[model samples]
Target: MDLKSTVASIVDWPIEGVIFRDLTTLMKNPEALRESCDIFYERYKDKNIDKVVGIDARGFVFGAVLAYKLGVGFIPVRKKGKLPADTIEESYSLEYGSGTLEMHKDSLDVGDKVVIVDDLIATGGTAGATVNLVKKLGAEIVECAFLIELPDLKGRERLNGCKMFAMMEFDGE
Candidate 1:
């Protein structure tokens, strides 16, 4: 569906010398959105994912829907204090410094298979933190999925030994 073309390129977004790949344009188009979701669903439908862990905000958009489509539960990996119940938190480095993320303490059982989802993969810090949180809960991460990947940042390197998938890849400003 050429989903990348549907995404808007924003120069110097959120910071200087950084180009943001905005999904709002692609998400607003029904065809592209549906196709993107369908592609993810089809790929992981047979992976027996017990839970789909979405990392905050945008991840929740497709993560919840993807979980429903696969008949699994959705676990939110949010910023600290967002979840009401007891939660497990992990702090990781960001491009500038550090940030933290949390998930419900009981969100996954021992040996439960999970797939982490997000809108994009940048430097892999967030995804790596999320993976650690899932492991600490005694759950196994089967795969990581994203809508877009900035290959130049080598985000996938932080996910060594874990299966990862993405719909599109870009190396740009």
Candidate 2:
């Protein structure tokens, strides 16, 4: 499916000088949504992933189902104070300022293989922060997966030391 067609772009949303490529349109289309999940499942089905960790909010949409298809576990790395019980958090820089993300302290184990998923990779701040949190548990990162990638932002640079996969890339949007 041409997933890009199902995406809608909004200029200067939530902030000026930024164009947000929204995926809600694609998500609502059953064919597009299924294709999106199928793409991720195909890549990781044989990777022996022990867990699928998703960033907060939108990431949850894709990450949870992918974990189910892979027959593994799903973990959510949410905004600070979002998770109950004892948690480990990491702070990272964003385009505007900074933010903190947290994950349950006991969600992972040493040497466990994990795949991080998110709706998109923009500046890579959130994704990178999640990666660091996973590392604290000594889990091996199988790869970082995303449905869309904006290459102009150099987000992947911050994702060094981790393999990344994106279904599609939007440049000069």
Candidate 3:
């Protein structure tokens, strides 16, 4: 299936000259949702991922399922103050503004293998911040995965050379 077609695009959302790639359309479709999960599962099933760290909100949707399918732990990288525990935070810049992400300090152990997951990668601020949090905890990142990528935004450059994968690309649109 062409997963890119499953996404809904909203123009000038949250600001002018910004296009939001909404995955809700894809999630609502049973076949699309299953296929999306299956794609990630097939790729990482044997990769020895000790944990699947999901970015706040959207990332949780696919990350939890992948963690279960791989039989590993699911760690949530939440927005600041959302996690009710001792947490570490990393701040990042967005197209319109700035925000912070937090994760529990005990979410991972030193040398644990991890794969970060998110719904989309635009400017990569969220993904990059999440990467820092993972590194601070001393977990080895296997790769960062996403459902959609906007290559035109050059988000990949912010990842500090960590390996990345996206199910589909919607670039130069």
Candidate 4:
């Protein structure tokens, strides 16, 4: 139900020249959140998704839910050392600086198919890093999905080896 309108935009948040797409407004609305999940559900329910790999933090909210709805396992791609087991990491650049993301070494296996889910895609650094991490495990990325996308940030340009989908997109201010 017009989820884009439910999202909030905070200009220059946590950094300058970056308009943060805050999903909390949409998260706080039952109907909006339900619709958002339902959109992902309807798209992937029939696909072969062995796991829904969620990016750290914000991605967990929708990624876990989508995995549950799709009847697949949920895997979290967290920050360095966050996972208890042996892990592999992919360092990436952020708007302000650089950071790293990690996934358990045994979390995925060769030939497995997965969908990378997150709250948003902006400047694509994290998504690109996650894609590389999945590749290292020899898994096939079915697709990447997001609730929101900022085309102005050109995040999609940095991603590779997967189709991308989003529920809502905010561009050109």
Candidate 5:
């Protein structure tokens, strides 16, 4: 299926001049959602990933399922103060604005391989912050995966050389 066609485009959301690529529409469809998870599963089934670190909210949906399929652990990178344990945080800038993301301090160990998952990559702020948090805990980032990528924002540049993949691309208009 054309996954991009399954996504909804909401113009000027969360702020003016910013187009939001809403994945909920795709997620609501059984075929689309299953295809998304299957794509990631097929890619990482043999990568020996120790954990799937999903960004707050949307990331959790795909990350958890992928982790289960890969038989690995799942870690959550949430907004600051959401995790109730010793945690590390990184601040980032998104197309909409800026925010801080946090993850448990003990989520990973040195040399642990992880894949950071999210719904989309826009300004790359959220993914970048999550990458920092994973690196801070001494984990090795296998790759950052997203369902959609907005190239116009140059979010991938913010990843600092880490490898990344997106199932679909959307123009930033």
Candidate 6:
């Protein structure tokens, strides 16, 4: 399936000059969603993942299911204060300013192998921050996975030394 076509392109979304690749369209299609999940599952089944840490919002959609399929725990890395329990926070740079993400302090055990998941990798800022949070908690970051990647942005540069995977790529903005 052409997952890109399933994604709806919204011009000037969230801000001018920004094109948002909305996954809600793709997620609504049963076959596309299933295939996408299956691809991730098949690719990482042998990676010895102890936990799947999903970024807030979109990541939750596939992360939970992927964790379940892998028979591993699903941990959530949410926006500031979104998690009710005691949390550890990491603030990182954004295009305009800074944003904060949080995860429960007890989400992962020391030396646990964790995989971070998100819907897209545009600039890699959020993914990098999530990795830092995982490190701070003493977990081993096995890899970072995404459904789409904006190659022209060079987001992968920020993730040096980290294993990164994306199902689809788009070069042009």
Top candidate (lDDT): 3
- Put down candidate 5 lDDT per residue, 1-173, tens digits, no spaces: 98889999998887888788899999999999999999999999999999999999999999999999999999999999899999888999887678999999899999999999999998899999998889888999999999999999899999988999999999856
lDDT by residue for model 4 (79-117), tens: 887899999999999667789999999999899999999
Over the stretch 1-173, how does candidate 2's per-residue lDDT look in tens digits? 69999999998986898888899999999999999999999999999899999999889999999999999999999999888889999998866568999999999999999999999998889999999999998999999999999998878888867999999999966
lDDT of 6 by residue, 4-41 (tens): 88988898877888778899999999999999999889
How displaced is residue 32 in candidate 1, in Å? 0.9
TM-score of candidate 2 versus the correct structure, residues matched by position: 0.97
| lDDT for each residue of candidate 3 in 1-173, tens digit (9 for 90 to 100) | 88778899899987889988889999999999999999999999989999999998999999999999999999999989899999999999977788999999999999999999999998999999999999999999999999998999889999989999999999768
Predict model 2's lDDT versus the native: 0.92
Q: What is the TM-score of each candidate against the true structure?
A: 0.96, 0.97, 0.98, 0.97, 0.98, 0.95
Root-mean-square deviation (CA) per prediction: 1.1, 0.9, 0.7, 1.0, 0.8, 1.2
Error of 3 at 6 (Å): 1.1
Which ranges of candidate 5 are over 4 A from the true structure?
A: none
Give the clashing pairs for model 3.
Answer: none
Question: By how many angstroms RMSD does model 6 differ from the true structure?
Answer: 1.2
Which 10 consecutive residues of model 3 have the lowest summed lDDT? 1-10
Pick by lDDT: 3 or 4, better one: 3
lDDT of 4: 0.90
- What ordering of candidates by TM-score runs from best to worst? 3, 5, 2, 4, 1, 6
Candidate 6 off by > 4 Å: none
Off by over 4 Å in 1: none
Query: How high is the lDDT of residue 60 in model 5?
Result: 100
